[model samples]
Target: MQPEDLVRDHTIYACVTGSRAFGLATDDSDTDRRGVYVAPTALFWRFDKPPAHVDGPLPEQFSWELERFCELALRANPNILECLHSPLVEHADATGRELLALREAFLSRRAYESFTGYALGQRRKLDADLRTRGAPRWKHAMHLLRLLISARDLLRTGRLTVDVGAEREGLLAVKRGEVPWPR
Candidate 1:
């Protein structure tokens, strides 16, 4: 089946993500959507197998096959873990509900490594931007800080939460470049 067909017919879970899902959206923020699709078992029996992921029958949309999604979640992938925690769920079937129910099974102390590693990578890019362009991408800097904060809190509380909650306004300010980068 085609990629859009897989998303349309086989998608089991989907949700809004990114700034909007983080409760940090501005009037101009894009609505980022993410999802999981369960391709038919029979599809994997073929030589072509199935696409591990598909991007966009809609703009700003992407999705992963069920097994791949679960595999990454188990590995404490920050993006996958955040996708599981997003409160703006757009769709969920029986399979999706089961996947959501397994959210905790997917989180572990390993997040300390995975989340920080991701944040550090982004930090390096921002640092490079600062050195080359004389200013880092403010929005990326804001999100990197948010990721680090989220990781720190998750490590402390043993809970994964995507929304920035009380930090929303401060983070938005940073996104707007109201907060200065370090000296």
Candidate 2:
């Protein structure tokens, strides 16, 4: 089957992600859509398996095959884990509901490392920008802070929450350059 066919006809779970999912969207932000689709089991018997992911039939949209999603989630992939925790769910089928119910199964002590490593990588990029340009990209800096917050909270609570909740105003200040950095 075609890539779009899997996303369109077999998608089991879908959600709004990125800024909107994090409760940090500005009026100009794009709606980022992510989803999981289950290709028929019969298809795997063939040589050319369905795509592990599809980039888009819609702009800023993407999807993963169900097994691949779960595999990454189990590996403590921060993006996959956060996608599973996204609060702006747009669709969930019976299988999707089952997947959501299994969300907590994806968390572990490993998350601390995963989140920290990703944050460190992003931090390095911002740090490079700061060193050469005299200022970090404030928007990326804001996200790194938010990611750190989420990682701390998740490690503390053993649960993941993708939305920033009460951290919104302060984070927005960082994003908008209203807050002084290195304070």
Candidate 3:
């Protein structure tokens, strides 16, 4: 079967991610999609292993094979961990639901490292923009700060929160370039 067929036939989990899932989407924001697919159990018995992942026939669509996904989440890979916790789920089957139920098992103190590392990387890019443009990408700066706060709260509370909650207005103001950054 073709790779897209695998995703179509075997996709076990799917969600809207990025700004949409983060409670930060504006009218023009792209819908970022993410998902995991489990290759049929029979596929592994063959000499050729199933593909580890497939990129979309549709824009903004991407998926991972289940085993590969679990491996990354076990290592506290920020993207994978966030996928499991995304609040904007679009589809999930029994297997996918079981995987979601294991979300906490996949999270550990290791996220203290991974989450902060990811946030710092984004912050660096925003800083670079500030250096060259006399202003940072305020939208990116806002997301970086949001990510840092998420990481801090996760470390302190051992809970993951994908949505910005009551902070939506403040964050959107940043996105509109209304928030000030120190020179």
Candidate 4:
């Protein structure tokens, strides 16, 4: 089946992510959408299996096949875990709801390692930007700080939450470049 067919017919869960889902949106924030689609099991029997992911018939939209999504989730992938927790759910069928119900099962102490590793990688990119452009991307810096804080709090409390809640203003300040890069 075509990638779009998989998304259009098989997508079981879909939600808004990025700044909007994190309660960090400004008037111009893009609505980043993510979702999971389950390819028919029989598809694997074919000469070519389904694409593991699809980039979108909609702008800024993307999705993963169910098995791939689960594999990543099991590894405590930061982006997949956050996608499952996004509050701005746009679509969900029974299968999708079942997947959401398994959100906690997909998390563990491993988050500290995965989230921190991802943050460190992002930090390197920011560092490169600092050297090349003379200024780090303020938005990336803000999100990196936000991810670290979230990971720290999740490790401490055993609860994963996407919204910044009380830290919204300060994070937005960082996004606006009001905070110094070193700070």
Candidate 5:
């Protein structure tokens, strides 16, 4: 079967991600879609297995096979974990709903490392950008702070929330370069 067909016909979970999912979207924000699909059992009988991920039939879209998605989620990959918790799910079969229900099972104390580690990496890049460019890219700086906040809240609450909620304006201020980096 065609790869796109897997996402088209076999997808079990799909949701909006990126700035839009975080409630930080502006008029120019691009819609980033992420999803998980279960390949038909029959397809595995062949020597060539179904792909573990697909890069989209639409612009800025990507999907992982269910097994791969689960593996990443269990490892607390920030992106995959956030996708499962996104407030805007576009589609979900019974399996997808089950996946949502199982979201909490994927969380563990280990996320403190995974999320913070990811944020730390981003932070270094932003620092380097500032050193070389005289200013960090406002958009990347905005996202780095957002990610650091998300990691802190997740570790504190044992819950994952993507929306900036009340912090939206402060973050938007950062994005607009109104907030100084030293602050």
Candidate 6:
């Protein structure tokens, strides 16, 4: 079936994500939407299983089938795990709510691996940017710090907290490029 078909007919959960969901949108921030959809249980009977992920008929929109999302989250896929924790949920059905209830199951010491690995990957790009442009992508650096803090807290508390909570102003300062990484 088409990606749009799955999104329209089977979407079990949906949310606004990225900077908007982080409570950190500026006037220029784009709205990023994300979601999970569940194919009818009977769809599995077909010889060809549904695709694990789909991109939009709408710009900047994407989705994963429910089972596929869970599987990837279990494997410590950072993007999939973050999708489960996005604070700006726009829609959720019974199945979707149950999935959210299991968010903790998806968390483990494994995040130290996935989260740090993601940070390292971003750092490389920042390093390259510094070489080419004489500065790191300060915006990406800010988010990396935020993500590291989140991973640290998740490891310490065994809970996922998406909002910056009391760190709002500090993070905003970082986002605004006031907190530069050492050169």
TM-score of each: 0.97, 0.94, 0.91, 0.96, 0.95, 0.91
Predicted candidate 1 versus true structure: per-residue lDDT over 66-180, tens digit per residue:
9899889989999999999999999999999999998988889889899989888888988899889988888888878899989988988889889999999898888788988
Q: TM-score ranking from best to worst? A: 1, 4, 5, 2, 3, 6
User: Which segments of model 4 are wrong by more than 4 Å?
Assistant: none
So what's the TM-score on candidate 2? Answer: 0.94
**lDDT tens digits by residue: candidate 6, 74-157:** 887777777789888999999889988888889988888988888887788788988999987777776777778778888899
Instruction: Give the winner by lDDT: 3 or 5.
Output: 5
Best by lDDT: 5
Question: Which clashing pairs does model 5 show?
Answer: none
lDDT of 4 by residue, 40-155 (tens): 98999989999999999799999999999999999999999999999889999999999999999998988999999988887988998889998998878887888898898898
Estimate the TM-score for candidate 1: 0.97
lDDT of 5 by residue, 77-179 (tens): 9999899999999999999999999999998877878888887787888888888987787887787888889888988898999998999999999999998
Candidate 4 lands at a TM-score of 0.96
Better of 3 and 6 by TM-score: 3
Off by over 4 Å in 5: none
Candidate 6 accuracy as TM-score? 0.91
Clashing residue pairs found in predicted model 1 = none
Worst 10-residue lDDT window for candidate 6 reads: 159-168
Whole-structure CA lDDT of model 3:
0.87
> Candidate 5, TM-score vs. the true structure?
0.95
Candidate 1's displacement at residue 45, Å, is 1.0
* Candidates' C-alpha lDDT: 0.91, 0.91, 0.87, 0.91, 0.92, 0.82
Lowest lDDT 10-mer window, candidate 4?
A: 174-183
Which residue pairs in model 4 clash with each other? Answer: none
Q: Model 6, stretches more than 4 Å misplaced?
A: 41-43
